[model samples]
Target: MTANLSTPPAIPAGTLPAGTLAAAPQPRLPAPGGLLLRPWAAADATVFLAAYRDPEIGHWHTRQPASADQVREWFDRYGADWAREKGAHWAVTGGGGEVLGRIALRGIDLDDGVAVCAYWVLQAARGAGVASRALTAVSAWALGGAGFHRLELDHSTRNRASCRVAAKAGFLLEGVKRSAAVHSDGRHDMHLHARVRDDGPPA
Candidate 1:
């Protein structure tokens, strides 16, 4: 889901412990061409809410349709995560700061020193390489800045678009976890993918 920066509570340093899979410095990066990957801000709530309300963006992930108040609450919870440096959320935008979608490095397993990544793009932004670029930007940051040696991403077996995004972001197909995801409709198989630190940039 796209994160709202106005959510408050900036990510703090050293909040994560030094362990095999705990906190590590991630690499910083410049925004991709034709796109910007910026830290989320609270003022972005309207754009975020609009994106979420789009059924195309909302249906694939676990997020249910949300109201404006619900969106605010979501940002608050995400802010708490950021404050601890346990994860990060970014707003994917156009050159002039038009919100296109949301991307995040979440589900950090501090003990394992790894994290899972997820992203979504607005319907209009689809097929424009927005997702691929965002994924690359975040992946670089995760591996370089966070000292995280490994990253994971997964998509439902039927979600070809997501699977493609994962691959375009440099994640290698690990395998499938049969009947692992319980979607709104029912359970479904999941395709797991991983990217080691040494993997080259997302193609």
Candidate 2:
């Protein structure tokens, strides 16, 4: 008997439905200390540009918007990413509704229930637990309500601040990826951290 090469084998269903994220409007998550993670808005162009222009932020995040128009375009792309269930981005706002930072889940794979988290805060917002709080809030939502199984984040090994934020958010330190990231200075080792749905709440 000849094997049938044209037929493909069956695969298991995805962990989440296709419309899990796109079916509903993106939500605004409230974090501790009166911080809110809301969808990015058109009016955020100014602060978005300013964030990229920040030396530390620029050094870490290499993609910088050259103008307000470019920033707006990026915002549009972010919305599109949401509709496509490809990614989710949020503007971290303070009690007064001022943009203090950003948090996002990139490279989403619903079938695998996995994504990579990224975030940054303005200089004024640093040293205040902004990143950790926002990160923890988002992780809870993603793993609980959104049905994601795992979330991962990595940063240059030299960035002790980010390491602390990841730990505070309950992302256990996995291991190091040698020369895995590039920064303004040069290529650097990256420390990988991750949280699974079973990790429970942040301690």
**Whole-model alpha-carbon lDDT for candidate 2:** 0.94
What TM-score does each of the candidates earn? Answer: 0.81, 0.93
Native RMSD of candidate 1 (Å): 10.2
lDDT of 1 by residue, 1-203 (tens): 98887797743432335442223322224557877777666788777878866776666666653666776777777766666666777788898778887788897766555888888998888998888888888788667765566789888898998988888888999999999987767888999999977786766
What lDDT is reached at residue 109 by model 1? Answer: 60
| Candidate 2, 1-203: lDDT as tens digits | 99899987654432676898999998999999999999999999999999988899998876789999999999999999999999999999999999999999999998898999999999999999999999999999999988999999999999999999999999999999999988988899999999999889989
Model 2: lowest-lDDT 10 consecutive positions: 8-17
Task: Record all residue pairs in model 2 with backbone atoms less than 3 Å apart, i.e. clashing.
Answer: none
Assess each prediction's global lDDT (C-alpha) against the native.
0.75, 0.94
Error of 2 at 146 (Å): 0.6
Off by over 4 Å in 2: 1-14
